[model samples]
Target: MDLQISVFLLFILFTAGHSFRCYDCLGLTGSCANQTVQTCPSGFSQCQSLTVVIQVGSITYKTKAKDCAPFCQSGSINFGFMKVSYSCCNTDQCNAQDAPDPSNVPNGKTCYSCDDWSCSNTVSCSGTEDRCIKATWIAGGKSVKGCASKSICDVTAFSNFKGISCCEGNLCNCEGNLCNGAQSITQSFLFLCCSLLSYFLLH
Candidate 1:
């Protein structure tokens, strides 16, 4: 027992004393050109790169970011109008490559999208976007709908927010084009959703 305890202590000390490095950069465009070596803080065991795409009507914006994370799950999140993809590695400067753009051919699924007050518009779902999501902005009493990947619909992802709901099947988040008019949410719930979105954007 003593020998095992001592070995465990030595292993912990070795890991704690080791410094991990990663390529760090954030860009509003599709690619990140300038990357700096960043020494990760303790508890951060992996390097991560994330790509996000937000589409509003005919306009589209994409951003790429690289940083250190305590832990990261490689996956993708889709919110009809927005999409996020993540990649992770466990070695020094391993996040040298940014996540790829998520532009898969349309997968024949369609869902309502809200670019303005009218949530009547629809967009095609692509790739792994197999779910429908609706989120109400409590402050504005308005709701937005879109196609999402099943990964983003995990219960733990939005457990604290009541304004957001995700469902499986086509147009399953709501039954009609004017679904936003009938749904209601609290301001606090929207705030939490925005904060969660911001964390992904800034971090």
Candidate 2:
């Protein structure tokens, strides 16, 4: 009987160790000042915080989210004019802190952007963006050129764009027919919190 009791206690301890309590939130705009706690599901190894900044023309939108992540990593993604930055941690409720906003200062990098009748418009790079990208769609015969973060330029974020090219120099996208310019970077800081949900979908 003693042996049986010891085995049950060991199982309880193992189960407790595997389950992690973390803060969860999603699709939050502005800030993450208010949040709730929940147990992370199996297969999730870390708590995560993701912040995305999407800019279209002059209007910029931000989204903040926290949940369980498969791994702990911090990186940024920039596509066209939209940019996303994320950070992940392994401690319980470690994601409680919000991510910093994208910087607004210019980084002295430049690239071409598309306009009504031409793709020769110039765009300034911002924040961690340091690459110039030129993407052409084979089916639609459309092309878009803009500045991007190094991480986003390296990743295959757009599978639909059949022809994609990236360069590191100012206005490098315009080397042959493109123009010349520099780039810049920026960040934001706002804390708007809400209830955190489970992070099991991070796998």
Candidate 3:
């Protein structure tokens, strides 16, 4: 009886430690795949990201929406299952959803562009996270937020470091209004955060 009880306790502990929901809810880009759409714009809906990538030959333009669901919550409707209507933003990829009007598309652009591929909804504890940006500011073009997730809007971080901009965690980093322009801030913050590590280890 004692051995059986111990085994059961161990299983419970393991299970509790392993259960978690990722930062991303769903969709290849963590762009609010579980949200529904609206038509009349009565109130607000679940917040979701919008991204578009346009590729013509070699050059590509990208656009990302910080949020979209709230803009179309009035006309939201249930399809059949829990698939939910993503019609808020018009795109070939979004069938049941109210996609943004393609006519609104700017010159030199496509209507469906998203780049959050390897991004896992896998929840993570306090630590460095990926920071990616779309290629262009246009509607769903081509972008590289350079993070596990594409848009900077859907970023999730602990309160300890949430003060930093989502663009702060970028890798391969390039020149831009994000991190590249704030080199001094990055270095200063790093030094402050690691001062203890440097002192303790060196000592």
Q: All models: lDDT?
A: 0.70, 0.61, 0.28
In the range 1-203, model 3's lDDT, one tens digit per residue, is 99999999999998766421111122324243464333323233333333333333465333323232323221111100100111233221233432331122122211111222321112211112233222331212212222222222253321111221234331333345333333222223223223322321121
Q: How far is candidate 3 from the true structure (C-alpha RMSD, Å)?
A: 19.5
Instruction: Give the RMSD in angstroms, all C-alphas superposed, for model 2.
Output: 9.0
Q: Which residue runs of candidate 2 sit more than 4 Å off their true CA positions? A: 1-12, 15-17, 111-122, 132-167, 171-203
Candidate 1 per-residue C-alpha lDDT over 1-203 given as tens digits, one digit per residue, 9 for 90 to 100: 99999999999999888799998988876788988999998888899898887765688878898998886756565555667777878989999999877756788887776553455567788877777777653335556577766755564333112365678777666656365544332335335345545666666
- Tell me each candidate's TM-score: 0.66, 0.55, 0.18
lDDT of model 2 at position 3: 100
| Candidate 1 residue runs with Cα over 4 Å from true position | 1-12, 19-21, 41-46, 56-59, 70-73, 89-94, 135-144, 158-164, 175-199
Clashing pairs in 1: 80-147
Provide the clashing-pair count of each candidate structure.
1, 30, 40
Cα error of candidate 2 at position 90, Å: 2.7
lDDT of 3: 0.28
Residue 11 shift from truth in candidate 1, angstroms:
4.4
